[model samples]
Target chain A: MMRRKLKVAVFKFASCSGCQLQILNMEDELLTLTDAVEFTYFLEASRATAPGPYDVTFIEGSISTPEQEELVRRVREESRILVAMGACATAGGIQALRNWLRLDDVKRAVYPNPEWVKALEHSKPVAEVVKVDYELRGCPVSKERLLSFIKQVLVGRKPYLRREALCMDCRRKGNVCVMVAKGIPCLGPVVQEGCGAICPTFGRGCYGCFGPSIDARPEALASRLREIGMKDRDVARLFKGFTGWSEKFRKVIDELEGGAR
Target chain B: MVSGGIYSGKFGELRKLFNALRLRGYRVIAPKLEDSVIRLKEVTSFDEVPYGWEDIQAPGKYSVREGGKHFRHGPDAPKRILYPPRLELFRLRPDWSVEYPKERFPPTALFAIKPCDLASISVMDRVQGGIGDPYYLALRKKLIIIVENCVEPGATCFCSTMGTGPEARDGFDIAYTRLDDDLVVFRPGSDLGVELLSELNIEPATDEVLRKYYDALKNASLKAKAPFELERLPDELELGLNSPVFKEVAERCFGCAGCNMVCPTCFCFDVIDEPELDGGAVRVRVWDGCFSYTYAEVAGGNFRKDLWARYRHWVLHKFAYWVRQFGVFGCVGCGRCITWCPAGIDLRETIKSVVEWVRSRGGS
Candidate 1:
């Protein structure tokens, strides 16, 4: 008897679709992946949609719309394993930036028909509404890593990954740190590892695309930033970026403000 | 074989060795003085080595100085040479339709490799080789390692904690420890090493010579300061995930990924399709870092938007999560992160604070 292929579905709600693109970007691995799994639903890659009960469902975007909120619940109920594929689905993502702003103002700016526009009060990750078997964090997940995750799942084993900060990779690569050599501020000591330390190589700093790492010490990092001559506003602006709406980051920003007040 | 396994030859013999290797179709690369840095470059002779040079490195300064004697390794030489700033894996076109030729790679030998560098290769092997990285494997396969045991240890040298050293280990094909009287003792590790020894017609090592060589290495290791004790870090980090310490650290983090660039074992990468001016394109992978705000962001939005969360993620991944997943600590105890951090944030101190926090919270 021939073995059955794993029925996989890729879903997106409110996102830049970069994570989905990362999947498409797996040029060499795509052929093998397509052969191994049945792509029953992936709106970006295919217009043909299949309904319900997928073996594995990958949710890429956050639930920002009321319709999406219900859709996520249905997807969660229908899938055997639900994996949050990017920052938007794992965390509130960039839309979480709206968490700090007035929701009415955002609606008015984006919708000429504010009366017709219907959205959730707050944007939230898929896990907030549904159970997620695994969460792959990143603005755009690394294709190499995504492939590894898929392969691991296919092979019936937990994925092996390094959960260290980017600083660890920075040290291993032997790049002269912008923080030390150029006196540039760097989140490397704290940011999660996954991206291959790219920005710094190209003379840029980390923007915290992977979401708050497990066990991050924002208080200590705040004091260090002050020592380097950064002001409270700068600190707040820094937190208010990609995952700016993350509860932990918001709390730190609030603390900085409270201290100043 | 001659006595003491020592080969006493003039500096001219070094050039002759390179010439012979070149004639045999091997590329000889060694440290050469370039832009005041000891950079690895193709060499034809001893004249190309950074002779009579040294460097001084401190908290935020690096400078090259002249040595009084000829053919002596510099004291303050930057270790950055061990890890190249950029290494081409394989170039691809933008369309992902084609890959570059693979014929440019030729078997080569890196002469005068320090024991610290040799140890770094072993660490890299575990990351790149063990992880199914064909690019690193191909580059590593065609190279021969010739190590020079540390005759002089740098102030920042602490390979002892990492179990690396002033002495060579299993990775090297041959090891050389410099001795007084202009002589060098060679220890062969593989058949190639043995053959090289035989070709050079070196003497057998005497008990006294071997004793002296080991004694010097041991002293070098001893002279180095001990790294901060971090036995409780992994557990401490797991419990401190919700602590304010991460927030504090993130406030100062500039989000620069310099640490990743200088690291010896980081293997994360991004694949991009580069289109030539012509129609064809190649898909290639380049190094990437998670410290950037966009590392975890999807097209819709970023997840680790906060610098604090990103910062905390890095530390936890290295010390705690990596161990839980890979059955080995991601860190090799190299002090490059601490020494190279522009903000002067030391990982040792950061981990120690976590340990203290865990103990205070009754979690340790």
Candidate 2:
């Protein structure tokens, strides 16, 4: 008796498609993954689209337009479980920096014909528009993490996401503290563990691509960044990265904008 | 057999010890300077040990330079070898068969270790050894610890305050103090140390050279400081439990748990069940800290929900609770926490805050 193959769908809105690319980067494991699940609707990978009612739907971008908003809500209704993948789906990626600016000015600067483009006033994560069952966060999501998520889902077990800070991974790897040793302002103390603290392992500071962890004290980290000679606006800009629109990081950006920097 | 003999040799003679350890089939874990950071990693060659390079460590600042005559300190500790950050305890298959992983405890020599780290090993021996953890105990038994006494302690060092360093009294099989770039003084602590030193083709120490070595040890002690006396620390921490200083320090703390990660005596761990799609589960253990927000969490809610509460728990556990638990302070006062913390939050300042809180009420 053969078990039914899980029907999976990958959707994108306004992202670089890097997170979706992680599926192809899975090496020989991609073949193993294909055997376990049928890719029902992957627009980037294939032109053929099957109507949803997907077992699992992976949303890869933020809802920056009215069409994406409608699609995400319908995907939520059609899927048993909807997982928002990458920084855009979890916490509106770098595009959310426009949330601080005038929407018309942002559109005019990016597009030659501002009237031709269609976008909402502010880009929002999938959770803001529709309930997201899970999130695999990163600028470009980790191949290992995505595989682990699928593996757990296949086993009918809840996927365990890490709540620890990126610094924990850095410490475990016995990597020298770039922020402490080099005076580089790092967001490892606030960002969640997912990428295995890759930046710090290479003697560089973490750029907070994984968003805030359970123990994130952004105000405390922001103040530390300031004490290390980072200018007010630069500190604000530092927090305004991939996960800037998230609550912990958004609070820092909001406070800085409110003249607390 | 007489133990605790002081011997003298050329600096290059230490290389002979490395050779002998390898010949005995022991992996030598020595300090190797790589990419500017001096790490206590496995080295096949003695030349890998950065002899004359020392690290300048301060609150949130560390760098390596050539002028210093002492061996530099790094973030890597001997604990990683004994009690690793992540380990698979066992695996349970679908057939209900348990597969225990082979012990990774190889015969290893901890070569050229500092005094503060030596003290940590002895402390962990009691902490983990007391509980009779098979892995840690097995790894501990296989170690050939060699200590390098601090002639010039790093900026973050406070081993003297903790009575753990500048000169290692015990815990190491063999100890050495660099007299200069070439000349060296050796002190044997155990029977194996005696055997190793006795076989050495080196001269006996003279009174004049020993005098100079003693002076340097004394000088190293004077350089490291404590905010106040630590004799009444547990009582002081008790009095300052409800004080505002913990909250004040927590304000600056990023809750990264950098201090706990770098601290020599921290031993908390979290157990996780990693179930595979093949119907197998691996019971894994990874390092955990009180400063972590997820610590003390249950099904209903987290016990230490606020960052300040977690921060207070860590400080109190190190100073007060550890005294009650192990009859010794959990913190060895190595100051690795201070040097490694991104926030530059110094425990010296935090300890002083506790003392100030205790003094404000005239309790002292």
Interface RMSD of each: 9.6, 1.7
- Alpha-carbon lDDT of model 1: 0.66
Worst 10 residues of 2 chain A by lDDT: A252-261
- How would you encode candidate 2's per-residue C-alpha lDDT over B231-313 as one tens digit per residue? 88889888888889888888998888888788878998888777665667788888888888776787876788888888888
What candidate 2 gets wrong by more than 4 Å, as runs, is A258-261, B1-3
Kindly report the docking quality category of candidate 1. Answer: incorrect
Model 1 lDDT at residue B295: 53
Give the least accurate 10-residue stretch of model 1 chain B, judged by summed lDDT: B70-79
Candidate DockQ scores, in order: 0.11, 0.68
lDDT per model vs. reference: 0.66, 0.86
